[model samples]
Target chain A: MDRQAILVELKKVLAPYIKNKELLDGITENTNLITDLKINSANLVDIVIDAEAQYNIEIDADSAENMVTIQNCIDVIEEKLSSANS
Target chain B: MHSAGNDVVAFRLTDPERSAQPRFYNQILSPSEIALFHSGALPSLSFHIFLWLCWSIKESAYKFRKRYHPDLVFSPTAIPVTEIRATAQQITHEGPQNASTDPQITGTDHQITHPVLQITGTDHQITHPVLLITNAAHQITHPVHVITGRTEDLFFRSELFPEGIHTVVYRHPDFKSVRSGYAFLQQALGSNHPQTNGATEPTPETQSAAVRELVLLDLRKRDPNGAWSFGKHKEGYPLLYRNGVLQPVPLSLAHHDQLLGFSYLLPVS
Candidate 1:
């Protein structure tokens, strides 16, 4: 529900796909999924699906496209979670 | 300013069963694209290849436009592939009388045959024909699907291979001088390299370096005396420099799984 909690969950979701464990350990809000973690673009969709299942929320195409960075993913998830709760 | 972009998708890394799921592909394809898939237009191709082909094209188009629009985000649904059609490669026969005078016909017996694809989109139009030549010595009759699509004003041509798919997007039709190529990442990285072993996987940094090396090697062959170097522009687009001077060429680099792809616009002589 909180940013830190969301990040923890996000890390768990991303850990399997990331080849560089060091980068994942040092990931920040500014860390890019493609450029930073070197996650394949094709795998981005899988991340989205995993995040959706983890958060129990649906991500539209617009929000999914903006999930290029860690912060972007958190923001979208938070927005979706709040909207669903409301 | 003519710009070019390219992307490659390797078959080994991607999961075909996962990609065919609606929940997965729904985020990637526009509503119209979904309709086109069921429209029987691509009846022969599997859903997995079709989906990845579209993904590669949109990725290339995003790169092509990113040079001009630095703030652009990649939205696959936003940049749609409006049309896709398969056409046979045309073979022109030149008679001896006109063979010498015809500039288009290079040899006396047969003309070059190309697998052509015509694609039209909302904001831009592209016609991509993969030039496969047939001569007295060899005949290449394999049909290649030429997919042309546009993102904003850019046009792209994509070729599907048994290994994967490669797509290249450019600014305009007149920028037909845009050329592209792809190679297996393992082969490009060198067969003797220790990392080439199956025990260790290739990192993105290593893959990027290998593609840059491959491009530079090809460029050096064209201009042997020029000192060639590859670097990125301030806008984060890959570029080439010769003798410390930035070449007018617009270049793009992409690698996925085991395939490395690069495309560049040739400077007018």
Candidate 2:
């Protein structure tokens, strides 16, 4: 799957948790989940769990710890997908 | 450098929807802790309290370790909350002995009891100095002095409110007595800022933002040096800096739901 496709899926997964509509509208690869979107830290757990189920990928604790940004999530998703394919 | 770390969890924030989610719990807790959590022994404690207890311990240990390991990326599973044992009886006796020597400390030293948590990790076994504040309704009946090992009997007092559960790691107990305080502000709702220090100034737009601002202000109120900077390692845990140099003093701030606060164990002369 292409990176853009993963981004699309990520947006869908993150839609329910986005607290700030303005941030959701303007979110980019650089948009920080916590700093920009104002998502509570506790909700991050739900997002990670949801992402795993959506993408059919497993995220180790190290990767999950750094998933502070949209780009970080996309990168991890893409990497996980690539590794799964291989 | 000596430091402390803390985390708070408001009971109202406990999401019933996510409570049944197994994957969510797995990510934050160790297998052993998970079992212990489900065990019948801790019937009085809720899952939210149990989770935050471990989280606070990890956070405290992380804050202490981050000083030396700034490059480290903290994984909660990397360090588990191995044990949280009460030291009230032991510390209560020690409190009066030291209180007699120090003129500044007041009241019955017995009132400051704080629990100590054992943290086990892949490469380290660390004892984190911790204080657990339960809701006023569910308050631990035994009130003990918050004594650090270094200060021996000097009690560092943390006022427990009736709201949520609070866990604080006072990493630097001996350098000086820990100055720990917290405040609950009216939720800023549409505006995002909560009234800080009961000041009339415009509050920050978000509770997290407001809590951080309040913590910085509280730290300055206690520290002789008003000038301070927050330095973070490559990852994002904060490093306390003062006078344009890294200070050994470790400071930690936490906010949950409607509450925000800070803790610092000041360096001794």
**Candidate closest to the true structure, highest TM-score:** 1
User: Model 1: clashing residue pairs?
Assistant: none
Note the residue pairs that clash in candidate 2: B112-B144, B112-B145, B112-B146, B113-B144, B113-B145, B192-B205, B193-B204
Q: Relative to the true interface, what fraction of contacts does candidate 1 keep?
A: 0.74
Could you tell me every candidate's TM-score relative to the true structure?
A: 0.81, 0.64
Residue B35 in candidate 2, Cα distance off native in Å: 3.4
Going through the candidates in order, their DockQ values are 0.75, 0.48
Poorest lDDT segment (10 consecutive residues) of candidate 2 chain B: B140-149
**lDDT accuracy of residue A20 in candidate 2:** 51
Candidate 1: stretches off by over 4 Å: B88-151
Candidate 2 deviant stretches above 4 angstroms: A15-18, A35-38, A56-63, A80-86, B38-41, B86-162, B172-176, B187-205, B216-248
Instruction: Give DockQ: model 1.
Output: 0.75
| Cα lDDT of model 1 by residue, A1-86, tens digit | 99999999999899878988888889999999988888988788889999999999999887998998999999999999999999
What CAPRI-style quality would you assign to candidate 2?
acceptable
How well does model 1 score by local distance difference test?
Answer: 0.69
